[model samples]
Target: MLRILRASGLSSSFTPFRALLSSSSSPDPQRGLSVVFFGTDDFSLPVLNALVEARDCDGSVASIEVVVPKLKDPSAKCTIESVARSAGLRVHVPNRRTTLKYWGLPGAPPPGGSDGDGDDDGEPMEIGPRYDVGVVASFGYLIRPHIASAFRLGIINVHPSDLPRHRGPAPLHHTILAGDTTTAVCLIDVDPTAFDVGALLARSPLDLTTLPDTPFPPPLPVLSSTLAGTGGKLVRSALRSWNATLDAAVDQDRLGAEPSHAPKVSKDDAIVPWATAPAAHVLRLHRAFAGSFDAQAFVTLPARRKPDGARKRVKLLELDVVAAGDPAAGDAAQLAPGTIAFDKPRKRLLVGTADAVGVAVGSLQVEGKAPCSAVDFANAYLRRLLGSGFVV
Candidate 1:
């Protein structure tokens, strides 16, 4: 039976997969399944590594083949590719526009599928021998029927959010920005036309609020790392005796919820509205944008008249919340919102926000300057002109 582990909390152990593997009886471990994997990002590393480790440990997974995006430069470093190669896994960089081309099937779309407008013509072309199953995580491209059909048992994907929710690319960012307390990793049967509409093989929920023991919410990478570990475990469990459990997969649509999409995070999404947005919201934005592909959350502070008479934007990073009316706030209570004040008693730079809440600045980068501590930034630039005055 398929198992569902909901987010009351998460266990750091890989005991779940190990337990399932030990009890397996359906397909003999001696027969051993071969796997072809599709993935390209850092988030996919853990899952791929887990599979590679499994293959090394037992004969359950006989072979590992990886497919990655075509690199513009042959010398470009792909972390997943590097890890896969180090594990002695076979790697293929297939062009999504012409997958069949990689296999010498000219004029035909790739076996699984391509990013083409229409479906393949006539009958589906057959690719060579098929692997037992396929797995994907953050592969960044859709699979066509031809490629999917090449596998005897089709493909399964490790998605970082609960099915029927956050059913898009940037789940990590959206989950944080929305103030979600919990997130889940789902191992789902891949569907070609619709994204993440596949049947659920396994679900492991993670409690985001309980991590890191911090006063504020955990950072984006913290939750991402946790989910990645959970995802890897789920994949291993789904593949063990997969022939038997595949048929038992549950339909996600029946879960009785409409999924909220997590579109790619945009530059506008990272802007910190210190003067207008709620303190919690500002903090969430900072936490969400931290370590993201895009730059960190920032607000443009008013520029002081320089010797050159040029104004520049001050990009802030490492923002943390401080309760209003802290004794160290001193005269900060009298300053306008968005002001930069030094909390001398606490030895931190405090940025005032809406509702009398203060955001402790750990680090910041002035335009055209290297990143520096908040105190260094104030002493070198802010204190001279603004004298701990309004930021804007």
Candidate 2:
């Protein structure tokens, strides 16, 4: 449901998917299941919207409340708030300074406010429930025991990657990084003080073996595309099924867990080090950085003479993974890891990697200009200065 919104990006930065989510579904909450949702990213949009749609399908929300972190920017804040408000969903942006207690129990309101342990940081805390079940999806804030205990059924988080696996931030990136071909969309119950400890109610496998209809290269575009709504659809379907078997949602094993963590990646993490990366790692790096936080396979070039006798450098973006079988692989394999070798007449740019794997450059952005193809990049900016020998 929300995947449609991700596909319709108006700009590279903020996703307008939330812009259309409100109008796409009905505003009524479902009967029986009342929930308090806590989320702050695009990953959480589908489950939240689905909950709203299911409840509002017939024109009335049985019970639902939202606790969203207060985004400093109004555009960002209003995007989700407007969607919720438009759908008649309750939107709760607890004051960080006033609601600081965990679960926001009737205690001294809260230090600084929002809900978490005693802390003076500006970050918002997950103030516990004023509702029945607490549902969190891609919520950046860490919810403490106070918050989880406040809810009768505990909190249910819509984790993108399979739990007991990629258990922290950047699950999708971590999973992709580990090169796991199979993963799951899990709806786990969050027990107090124990993250990933709640019962495993639903596990829907995610197959990443095949690329999407519209393919975006790694390191940047892929992670930022916000194209996981179909995955969310599967989660919504699984949740509905779980609701039927609510009693069966049992606690998972504490042992035998191969836990992994994907801490929030920063701009500094985006800098690619071609000298050390293996082919597989290089490919994975690009995919992990793709959508958000400036995903790209950046390059720096050696000084080469220009028509005006000045040395020129290049910055390349977007690379396609290729194996030894492709016709371009052999030629690409010979170029240096960061060299730019172009077959402009055929519109091909060969990018070599420290690993044996070769990457074919597809789209690129040079000094101050729109994204251009390998052919254009070569003809206009390269070619004369680079007679080959430069590696990908």
Candidate 3:
């Protein structure tokens, strides 16, 4: 039987279903596990889909519910709420983003009740396991200790990078920016105090060499999609062999690998350091952030007819490293870093780098103008400023 708890002002609804096992009992392989799935972005969709499929087809998942962040905009498209509803699954959301920090599992007793100390009313708390397990993927908020302890088994997270490496909010973005040749999707136990420092439950390596058509260091979206698919399979397998995978889990701190951090990508990262960074570095920056909603690489160019050295920001929409044999590449070697010149023969804008190599700009967008091709930018913005050689 399932019981629904509906919120008054928010679109949140919770369906509490009894687990096959008792509160103190371990998961029964024959009966499968009840799951509370927490996720938010596109990367989380594949794993959620896998669990939903498992619930219907196999015995790996008994029941599943989704918990997403409250929708701030009702008309927003491509949200997890819409996706879960379309799949006919019950969804739960917090009243506000900050509410998650004090959130408790649905059907679980309120904090400061019989489960611990009595509440202000001195009423007894209902105590028992609310769900068999919790699974989180790309759910930006932290799950507090009280919320994690409500489940029979603690929360498991699907992290994009290998354990003990790239541990933070923007692992995928950091992976691409670092030009790493290999990465992996990992399933780990969620540490209540920190993020991405969980015990490793499973992992599937993404071999860059095997990606077809594109050269090494493919675009961020391509790599992200591939990793998401792998993560789905890995989590499914872990749940299918629940006991064995749990018993074999290893602590990330004990793993001997050096730890690294992947802080959130910011506007500062979008500023192209043409004067100090190499051409390859700039290319990596473009690949990492070009597809992002806000963070795209940009250069500060001198404003037209401004004696105060006023500058305008031009976003580099598309960029490529100039081959050593290209004529523009040779001409760029003679110019200083941050210097830009229009290559008439190639019909592209070439900019020098710190390494004396040039990078070709395929398309760009001025501060207030629509994106335009390199040829158009050169014709309109470069022709008049050629005497001074429009240096960024």
Better of 2 and 3 by lDDT: 3
Q: What is the alpha-carbon lDDT of model 1 when measured against the actual structure?
A: 0.66
* Candidate scoring better on lDDT of 1 and 3: 3
Across residues 1-392, which tens digit of lDDT does each residue of candidate 3 receive? Answer: 00112222221121121211112445785698999988888888898988987888888999999888766675663367789999899887754554443345566654444332222433223244577888888887656445555567656788889767898888888887888888899988775445576678888888775798876677778887888888888888878877777667777888899999888877678777767888888888877775774224443344558654445567787788888988676887766777778887877888888899878888888778998988998777774442344334
TM-score of 1: 0.79
Better of 2 and 3 by TM-score: 3
Please list the Cα RMSD from the true structure of every candidate, rounded to 1 decimal place.
Answer: 8.5, 10.4, 7.2
Model 2 agreement with the true structure over 1-392: per-residue lDDT tens digits: 00001122122322121221222322123444567777666666776777777566733335777777766664567345667778887777755522323335444244246444445543223343444466677666656433443554445667666667766667777766677776677666554434555566666665555556534332333432233454455445544554443554555574366676666667546545666666666666666656554334443334545333432323345666767688777777776776667755457777667875767767666545687888777776664443342322
Off by over 4 Å in 1: 1-30, 96-129, 212-216, 293-314, 329-335, 383-392
lDDT of 3 at 355: 92
lDDT of 1 by residue, 229-293 (tens): 88888777777757556656677878897878888767667776656866678788878877753
**lDDT of candidate 3 vs native?**
0.71
Query: How close is every model to the real structure, measured as TM-score?
Result: 0.79, 0.71, 0.84
lDDT of each: 0.66, 0.55, 0.71
